[model samples]
Target: GESVGLHLPTLSVQEGDNSIINCAYSNSASDYFIWYKQESGKGPQFIIDIRSNMDKRQGQRVTVLLNKTVKHLSLQIAATQPGDSAVYFCAAEGNGGADGLTFGKGTHLIIQP
Candidate 1:
């Protein structure tokens, strides 16, 4: 999984292929994590989620893997299509203070023909 911060902000992918969007979480102490996909002009849509206790989670053509050691996470999209083209990002719940999630930058997934 790629690190998320002021440094990494986006990712691009081709159509009809598998896309792996990497993400580095900020807090190892965070309990929950979520992935969202935001299409053009639309709100962020929930993709999948995982707990810090879990190593991996799978969904319909999607998978979320978590590594607590390096504090990394990745989203795997199978047979990514044009409809899958969007900004993908991850969110981690604050350690204790707030109940809100700290979101990573939007990774704009372009469907290259």
Candidate 2:
């Protein structure tokens, strides 16, 4: 079973298609969530973020959806290209005034040619 704040594993998609990734957070009080994409050797780059108050957010080619009830979150990629292939993860922060954000492990996104 998926626990709150638990990380999802990986997702594989073909080039030019859409890909969806999922996440879950433990903190009901968490008001902020961020999505990151990390490449082979580089650091994780910010993709997008959403506030708990909002059910969803959209970026250039990405969209993030949040479900507070289930403590679930998801990231959607439009026209997934090879460049979008990377390890993706989600981080969450609450009103606790914590120093660092709580994050999921990561999901390896593979772009099949």
Candidate 3:
């Protein structure tokens, strides 16, 4: 079965610094990618997304980059803050629908003082 996974389980970034989170997907047919931020005891929140046709997309203070050739995805968060600490996940969908989405294990983003 196709699955998505993160290269690292945790990432620590200093306050006001930029943070980059990486993910890898096994489904080569996936056409859509999404980045989600999950706070403790809450549902994942949508951060940003990118389509297969586009190499990169930006939203607010976040950026999502997709590399189809390597089946890789990345999320960049600008200006790390205390509120930015959470578990970030990368999800992939092959059929352009949420039903077919596969989510990664998630990477814990820690904001350091």
Better of 2 and 3 by lDDT: 3
lDDT of 2 by residue, 1-113 (tens): 12234355767888999998988887677888899999989998999999989999999999999999988999999999999988998888765545467778889999999
TM-score of every candidate relative to the true structure: 0.87, 0.90, 0.95
Against the hidden true structure, what lDDT does model 1 obtain? 0.80
Name every residue pair that clashes in candidate 2: 5-24, 5-25, 5-26
TM-score of 1: 0.87
lDDT of 3 by residue, 1-113 (tens): 67999999999999999999999999788888899999999999999989899999988889898899999999999998999999999999986574678899999999999
The positional error of residue 56 in candidate 1, measured at the CA in angstroms, is 0.6
* Candidates ranked by TM-score: 3, 2, 1
Best model per TM-score: 3
Measured on C-alpha atoms, candidate 2 has an lDDT of 0.85
After superposing candidate 3 on the true structure, give the runs of residues whose Cα lies further than 4 Å from its correct spot: 96-99
Stretch of 10 with least lDDT, candidate 3: 93-102
- The Cα RMSD of model 2 versus the native structure comes to 2.7
